[model samples]
Target chain A: MLLLITRTFKESIRSILRNGWLSVSTISILVMSLYIISVFFVFTSTANEMLKEIKNKANISVYFKADAEEGVILAAKTEVEKMNEVKSVEYISKEVALENFKRTNANEPVILESLKEIGGNPLLAALVVRANNPTDYQTIDENITKATFSEEVSRVNYNKNKELINKLNSVIETIQKIGISLGLLFAAISLLITFNAVRITIYTHKQEIEIMRLVGASNMFIRLPFIFEGIIYGIVSSVVSVLLLFISLKFIASYVSLTIPTVSLMNFYLANFGTILGYQILLGSFFGVIGGLMAMRKYLKV
Target chain B: MINEENIQEEKNKIMIKFDNVSKTYKGDFMALEEINLDIAEGEFISVVGQSGSGKSTLLKLIYAEEAATVGEVYFDGNPLSVVRKKNLSAHRREIGTVFQDFKLLPRKTVYENVAYALEVSGAPDEEIAENVPQILDIVGLTTKAKKYPHQLSGGEQQKVAIARALVHTPMIIVADEPTGNLDPIASLEIVRLLIRINELGTTVVLASHDKDIVDKANKRVLVLENGRIIADYPQGKYKIS
Candidate 1:
C-alpha cells in the first residue's frame, strides 16, 4: 500500500507540473486576491487606530468651586470614576490647574495677557473624566451631575465634547462595518476567480483525468498534486503580496512621518502585525487552497 | 445440489466468468447481446470481430467502462455493477489496458506515461525507480523513455502503452485494437510484444479486425457478429466470413 501510494503521488506531481504556465497563471490570480485582502485589512487596522486616538483626545474636564475642600473634590472624582460608563477621573487642584495652563500656553501671548488681566489664578480646580468608549460620554456626564458633591461643582463641561465624540464614534463604526463587509465581499470574489482559473485548467485535462481513472489512480493520487499546486500558489502569492505591501507601506509611512510628524504609520504597522499575519494567511493560503480543490472537484470524480 | 461447498470453492478461484452480458447503446441499437464467456488465468485470448460487433464492448465490460445493461459480468466472481468507488482504483489497477488509438498521455514523457498508473496509486519512489525502467526495457522503450508521446513513432507510443499496462503486473492485459494506428510492421511488432508479455505469465486479451494478424495469432479466438458470439475455438484461425 505504501509503495502504491507513493507512486501515485509522484505521478500527480508530474501531471500538475505538466500544465506549466496555466498553473502559474492561476497562482498569480491567488496572489493578487490575497494581496488585496491583506492590504484592505491593514488599512482597516490603521483606520481603527486613528479613530481610537481621536476618542482619546475628547476628554471632558469638570471644574469645582475655588473654596471647595480637597475631600469634596476627591469624593466627586471617586464617584465619577465608579460609574459604569466612565473610564477614569482625576482631581486637579487650583494650583496644579494654573501650573498646567501656564505650561500649555507659554508660547501663546493672547492666553498669557488674559491670564495677567485676571490678576490671580482664574482657572478653577477640576476633575478630568474620560469614558471607556467614546460613545458613552453622555452617561458619564449624567453620572457626574447626580454625584453626592454636585453642589461643590462650579460647572460640568462634558456637554461640549459629547456631540463631537458621538460623531467620531459613528464615523469609526461606519468605517469598521464597511471595512469588514467589503473585506469579506472581495475575499469571496477573489476565492471565486482563483477557483475558476483552476477549474479551467482541470477542464483542459479532462480526457487525461478519465484516462487516470481507467488506469486505477486513487482519488488522492489524482488530488494531491492539484492540492499542492493550490497551496504553492497561496504561499507564493502571499509572499509576493506581503513583500509588496510592507515595502510600499514603509515608504509611505516614512513620507507621512516627515510631513505630519504626528501620524505614526510605522508604529501602527509594528503594533498590529500579529493580526495582519493571521489575516494574510487566512486570505491568501486558506482561500487559495480551497479555491484549488473546489476547481478540481469535477475533474477528480471517477 | 449435492455440492454447496463446491460452489464456494468455485467462487474462490474463478479469474473471470461472464454469465450473460448485453450492452445496448441509446435507441434500439444493441452493442452486445447474450455473451457467455470464461477466461482462466494466463490465457492469451484475442477477441476478433468487425466494427460494431461488440468486441470493444466485451473489453469495456471487463474494464467496467460501461455496465452490462442486463445480466452480470463478474471478475473473480465479484459483481462489476456494485464495485464501490473507493475500490475502483484497486479494481482497475488489477487490469491494465492498451487502447486501439494508443492512448498515451500526450504531454508526459514516455517514462512518465509508463509510470503514471503507479504514480496515481502512490507507488514508492524506489519501487517506481526499479519497475518503470524494467517495464520500459521490456517494451523496447528504454531508449525513448524521456520522449513525449507526440515525439515518438506510433510503434514506440504503443510500446509505452503496453509498458504502462505491464508495470502493475496486472492479472490481464486488454488491448482494444492497439494496432489501429500503426502500419503493418508496427502492428506486427505490437502483436508480437503482446505475445512476449503473455509468455511472461500475464493473461493477454487482444481485440482486433486485421484478418492477417488474427489468423496468424493461433490462439483462442472468440468471433462475434452483431453483438453475439458467432464462434469460440481453441487455437482458432480468423474466419470473419
Candidate 2:
C-alpha cells in the first residue's frame, strides 16, 4: 500500500512536469479564481465591519413636549431602556442640546447672533434610543410611539431620518446579495474551467491510460495518480494565491488607509490569515478534485 | 457430472477455453461467431487472419477486455463473465498484453514504463529493483532503459512494451499485431523474443497478419476467415495454398 501511494505520488509529479504548460495554465486559473474569492472575502468582511459601525451610530431621538416635566421624561427614558429591542437610552436636556448646537456651529457668527437674539433655549429635551441590531430599530421605534408617554412626546426623529435609514439598509442588503451571488458565480466558472483543463490533460494521456489498464492496473490504481495530480495543482495554486494576496494586501495597505482611514487592509488580512488560507486551500482542493474526477470519468471506463 | 478433483485437473491442463463464444458489435455486425477453442499451459499459438477476421477480438476475449456476446470465455475454468468487476484486475494481472502501437507512455523513461506495471501492483521496492533490470536485459534494452519512447526506434519501443508486460511474470503473454509497426528486422527480433519467453514456460499467443513472421513462427495456428475458424494447423503457415 505504501509503495503504491509513493509511486502514485511520483507519477503525479512527473506528469505535472511532463505537461509543463498544461500544469502551469491550470494552476494559473486556479490562482486567479482563488485570489478573486479571497478578495471577495476581504471586501465583504470590510463591508460588514463598516455596516456594524454605521449601525452603532444609528439611533432614534425622541424629543419631549416643551411643557413636559423632566421627571416624566426621565421615567420615559427608563421605560424605553427596558424594551427588549432597545440597547440603551440616553437623556439629553434642553440646555445641553442647545450648548451642543452652539459649540458645533461655533464658527458661524450669524448663527451665534441669532441664537443670542432668542430669549431662551428653544431646544427640546429628548431620549436618544439605541438598538441591539439594525433590524430591531423598526421594532424599537414602534414600541416608543405606542408608549404611555406618547402624548408627552413632541415628535420621534425616526420619521425625520426614515429615508436615510431605509436607503442605508437597502444599500447594505444589496451589497451582501451581490457579494454572495458573485462568489457563487465565480466558483462555478472556476470549476468549469479547471474541469476542462484537466479533461484536456487526461485526453492527451488517453493512450497511456489504456496501456495501464492492459497491464493490469486496477481502477483505483489508475485513479489515484490523477487525483494526486489534481491535489498537487490545488496545493500549489493555493500557496501562490495566498502569497499573492498577502503581498498585494501589504503593498496596498498604506494607500488604502490614506483614502479610507477606517479600513486597514493589511490588518484585516493578518487578523484573518488562517481563515483566508484555509478557505483558499479548501476551495481550491474541492475544485481540483471535482474537476479531475469529472474529467477522468469517461476515460476510466476502459 | 464431474467431481471437484476432475474439475481441478481440467483447470490445471487448460490455460484458456472458449465455449461456443461469439461476439457481435452494435447488434448487427458479427465480429466472431460460434468459436470453440482451448489453449493448454505453456503452449505457443498464433492466430492468423485477414483484416476484420477477429484475430484481435480473440485476443481481447482472453484478457476479458471484450465480452463474448453470446457465449462464455473461461480462464482456468473460471468463466470471465462470472468474475466480479473488482476481481477483473487480479485476473488480468495473470496475462500480459502487448499492443501493435507499443502503447508506451511517451513522457516516461523506458525504465519507468517497465517498472510501472510492478508499481501499480504494489510490488515492494526490492522486488521492482530486482525484476525490472532482469526483464530489461531479457528484452535486450538494458542500456536504453533511460531513454523515452520517442527517443528509441520502433523495435526498441516495442521491446519496452514487452519488458513492461513481462515485469509481472504473468503466466501468459498476448501479443496482438506486436510487429505491425516495425520493420522486418525489428519484427524478427520481437518474434524471437516471444519465442524465448514461450520457452521459459509462459504460454504465448500471437495474433498477426504479417505472412513472413507468421510462417516463420511454426507454431499451432488458428486461421479465421469471416469470423469463423477456417483451419486449425499444428505448426501452421500463413497460407494453406
Candidate 3:
C-alpha cells in the first residue's frame, strides 16, 4: 500500500510538472478567485462592524413631566432596566439635563442666552433606554408607555427616530443580501472556469489515461493521481492567493483609510489570518477537487 | 455425455474460449459474429484481417476491454462477463496489452514505461527493482532505458511496450497491430521478438494485416472478414486472395 501511494504520488507530480503551462493557468485562475473572495470577506466584515456601531447608537430617551419626582424617575429607570428587551437605562436628573443643554449649545451664544433667560433648570429628568437589538426598541417603548406610571411620563422619543433606524436596519440587510449573492455568483463562476481548466488538462493527458487503463491499473490507481493533482493545485493556489491578498491589502490600506477612515483592511485581514487561510484552502480545494473529479469522470470509464 | 468435471478439465487446458460470441455496435453494426474458438495454453495465434474486420474487437474481448454482446468469452477457465468491474483490473493484469500506437507515456523514460505496469499492480520495490531491468535486458533495451519515447525509434518504443507487457509475466500477451507504425525492418524485428517471447511460454495473440509478418509468424492463423472468420489454417501462410 505504501508503494502504491508513493508511486501514485510520483506519477501525479510528474503529470503536473509535465503539463507546465496548464498547471500554471489552472493555479492562476484559482489564485485570482481566492483573492477576490478574501477581499470580499474583509470588506463585508468591515461593513458589518460599522453597521453594528451605528445600531448601538440607536436608543430611546424617555423624559418625565415637569413636577415629576426624582424618586419616580429613578423607579422608572430601575423598571426599564429590568425589562427583557432593555439592555440598560440611565437616569438623568433635571439638573444634569439642564447642564447638558448648556454644554451642547455653548457654541451658539444666542441659544445659551435663551437658556439663561429661561433659567432655573426647566428641563425634565429622563431615562435613556437602550435595547439589546435595534428591532427591540419598539417593544421596549410600547411597554414603558403603557406602564402604570404612564401618567408621569412626558413622552417616549423612540417614535421620532423609528423611521431613520428602521431605514438603517433595512440598508444593512440589503447590503448583506447583495454581498452574499455576489459572493456566491463569483464562486460559481470561479468553479466553472477551474472545471474547464482541469478538463483541458485531462484532455491533453487523454492518451496517457487510456494507456494507464490498458495496462491493468486499478481504477483507484488511475483516478488517484488526478485527485492528488487537484489537492496540490488547491494547496499551491491558496498559498499564492493568501500572499497576493496580503500584498493587496497592504497596498490599498492607506488609501482606503483616507476615504473610509474607520476600516483598516490590512489589519482586519491580519487579525483573522488563520481563519482567512482556512477558508481560502477550503474554497480552493472545493474548486480544484470537485472540478477535477467532474471533468475526469467521462475519461475514467475503464 | 460430457460430464461437468470433464468440462472443467477441458476449460483449465484452454487459456481463452469464445462460445458463439457476437458483438454489435451502435446503429446495429456487427463487429464480430458467431465466433467460436479456443486457444490452449502457451499457443501463439495470429488474427489477420483488413480494417473494420473485427480483429481489434476480438483482441478487445480477450483483454475484457469490450464484452461479447450476445455470447460468452472465457479467459483462463472463467467467464469474463462474470468478472466484476472492480475486479477487471486484476483480470487485465494477467493479460498484457500492446497497442499499435505504442501508448508509451511521452514524459516517461523507457525504463519507467516498463516499470509502470508493475507499479500499477503494486508490486514490491524489490520485485520491480529485480524484474524491470531483467525485462529490459530481454527486450534488448537495457542501454536505452533512460531514453524517452520520442527519443527512441518506432521499433525501440514498441520494444519498451513489449517490455512493459512482459513485466507482469502475464499468461497472455495481446498485440493489436503493434507493428503498424514501424518500418519493414522494424516490423520484422517486432515479429521476431514476439516469437521469442512466445518461446518463453507466454501465449501470444497478434493481430496484424501485414502479410509478410503474418507469413513469417507461420503459426495458427484465423482470417477475419466482415466480423466473421473466413478461414482458419494451422501453420497458415497468410494466403488470402
The lDDT of each candidate is 0.78, 0.86, 0.85
How well does candidate 3 score on lDDT at residue A158?
Answer: 80
B46-92 per-residue lDDT for model 1 (tens digits): 89888989889899889887888888888867888876434778888
Top candidate on lDDT is 2
lDDT of 2 at A301: 70
Residue A170, candidate 1: C-alpha displacement in angstroms: 4.1
| Per-candidate interface DockQ score | 0.58, 0.58, 0.61
Best by DockQ: 3
For candidate 3, the docking band is medium
TM-scores for chain A over all candidates: 0.80, 0.78, 0.79
Residue A130 in candidate 1, Cα distance off native in Å: 2.3
Those runs of model 2 whose alpha carbons end farther than 4 Å from true positions after fitting are: A63-78, A81-84, A90-126, A132-146, A151-165, A247-260, B1-12, B82-84, B106-109, B143-157, B181-189, B211-216, B234-241
Candidate 1, residue A44: lDDT: 60
Ranking by lDDT: 2, 3, 1
Ranking by TM-score: 3, 1, 2
Q: State candidate 3's DockQ.
A: 0.61
lDDT of 3 by residue, A139-166 (tens): 9889987887889999888845566666
Candidate with the larger DockQ of 1 and 3: 3
Mark the 10 consecutive residues where model 1 chain B has the least summed lDDT. B8-17
Model 1 clash count equals: 16
State each model's C-alpha RMSD to the native.
Answer: 4.0, 4.4, 4.1
lDDT of 2 by residue, B79-147 (tens): 998763557888878999998988888877999999888877778889989999999999999999899
